[model samples]
Target: MRITKVKYKDALIQALLFIYLIFTVYPVFLMVITALKTNAEIIKHPLSMPIKLNFSGFIKIFTTQNFALYFRNSFFVTVLSILITVFVSILLSYALARYKMKYVNPLSIYFLAGMMIPIRLGVLYINELLNTLNLIDSLIGLILVYTAMTIPFSMFIFMGFIKMVPVELDESAYIDGCSERKILFRIIAPLIKPAVATVTIYNFVPIWNDVYFPLIFIHSPEKKTLLLAVTIFFGQFQTDWSLVFSALTVATIPVLTIYLVGSKYFIRGLTSGALKG
Candidate 1:
C-alpha cells in the first residue's frame, strides 16, 4: 500500500511539471512560428502555423536595417562587461574570503548595500560621470556602466564559492613558496569554475537585453545595442508584427545559446556549495 501511494504522488508531481513546462515554452513556440508568417497572415490568424515559411523579416533586418551592427555592439558590451566584472569581483571576493583584515566586514557590507538598492536609481549620476569621462555616446561608456552594475552581485557569488574553499590550501601553497598571485590564480582559481560560469551567465542576460541604459546613453545609430536598435520597427500608426517577431527571435538566440552552453555549470554551481570537502 505504501509503495502504491508513493507511485501515485510521483506521477502527480511529474504531471504538474509537464504542464508548467508547456506553459513556459508555449510563448516562445508561438513567437518562432509567428516570425515565419507574413504580417497579413499574423493579423488574420495570430496563432496558426504559417502557410509557407517566410524568411523576409530575418533577411530584411540583416540586409537593410543594419541589424548586424546591433548584434556586434551587444556582443562587445556583454563580453567586456562580464570580463571586467569577473576579474574585479573574483579578486575582491578572494580577499574577503581569505583575509582577516579590520575592514573586511565593512567592505562586505558595502557590496551588500549596493545589492540591496537598484542600480537604475542612480542613472543620473552614472550619466554625469560618463559625460565627465567623455564616454557618453560610446560603447566603452556602456561597458563601464554594465561592469559597475553587475560587480556587486558577482562579488557576492564569488565570496560564497571562495569561502567554501578551505583556507588550508592557501597555507599549504604559501609554505611551498607560491606567491599570493600564484595561490589565487593557480591554486584557488581552478577550484571555482562553477562560480565563474554562474557569474558569467547571470550577468550576461541583463547586459545583453538592457534597453534602458542604451536608450539614455547612446544617441548614435552605430552604437545602439540589439534591443535598442529593434525599436525602429515600431510606428505610431502601425507596427511591423513580422519584423518585430523576427528581431525578437534573433535577439533571443544568443541568450539561449549562452545559457545552454553554460547550463551544466550553472546548475552545478547552484547545487554545489563552493569547494566544500
Candidate 2:
C-alpha cells in the first residue's frame, strides 16, 4: 500500500512537471512557427502551423536593418564586461578567502551591499560622471556599467568557491616558492572553474538582455545593442508580426545557445558554490 502511494505521488509530480514544461516552451514554439509564416498567413492562422518555410524575414532583418552592427556591439560589450568582472572578482574573492585582514569581512560586506542597491538609483550620479568623462553613448561606458553591476554577484560566487578550497594547497604552493600571483592563477583558479562558469553564465544573460542601460547611455543607431535594436526594429515593423517574430528569434538564439552549452557548468558551479559556502 505504501509503495503504491509513493509511485502514485511520483507519477503525479512528473505529470505536473511535463505540463509546466509544455507551458514554458509553447511560446517559443509559437514564435518559431510564426517566424516561418507570412504576415498574411499569421493574420489568417495565428495559432496554426506554417504552410511553408520562409527565410525572407530572417534575411530581410540582416539586409535591411542594422542587425549586424547591433549584434557586434552587444557581443563586444558582453564579452569585455564578463572578462573584466570575472578577473577583478577573482582577485577580490581570493584575498577575502585566503588572507587574514582586519577589514576583510567589512570589505566583503561592502561589495555584497552593492547587490542590494538598485543600479537605477545611481543613474543620475552615473550620468553626471559619465558626462564629465565624455563616455556617454559609448560602448566603453556600457562595458564599465555592466562590469560594475556584475561584480558584486560574481564576487559573491567566487568567494564561496574560494572558501571551499583547502588552505593546505596554498601553504604547499607558498612552500614551493610559488609567488602570490602564481598561487592565485595556477592553483586557486583552476579549482574554481565551476564558479567561474557560473558567474559567466549568470552575468552573460542579464548583460545581453539589458535594455535599460543601453537606452539611457546609447543614442547612436549604429551603436545600439541587439536588444535595443530589436526594440526599435519592432517599432518600425510592428505591422508585420512575422518580421517582428523573426527578429526576436534571432536575438534569442545566441543567449539560448550559450545557456545550452554551459548549462552543466552553470548547475555544477551553483550547487558547489552554495553547498561549500
TM-score of each: 0.89, 0.93
lDDT of 1 by residue, 162-253 (tens): 99999999999999999999999998889998788888987888899898999899999888899888765555114677888898899999
lDDT of 2 by residue, 1-277 (tens): 9999999999999999999999999999999999999999999999999988988899988998778888999999999999999999999999988889998999988998887788978998888889999999999999999999989888888898899999999999999999999999999999988888899997888899999988888998889999999988788888988889999999999999988999886676556545643
Error of 1 at 82 (Å): 0.4
- Any residue pairs clashing in model 1, and if so which? none
lDDT for residue 261 in candidate 2, whole number 0-100 = 94
TM-score of 1: 0.89
Best by TM-score: 2
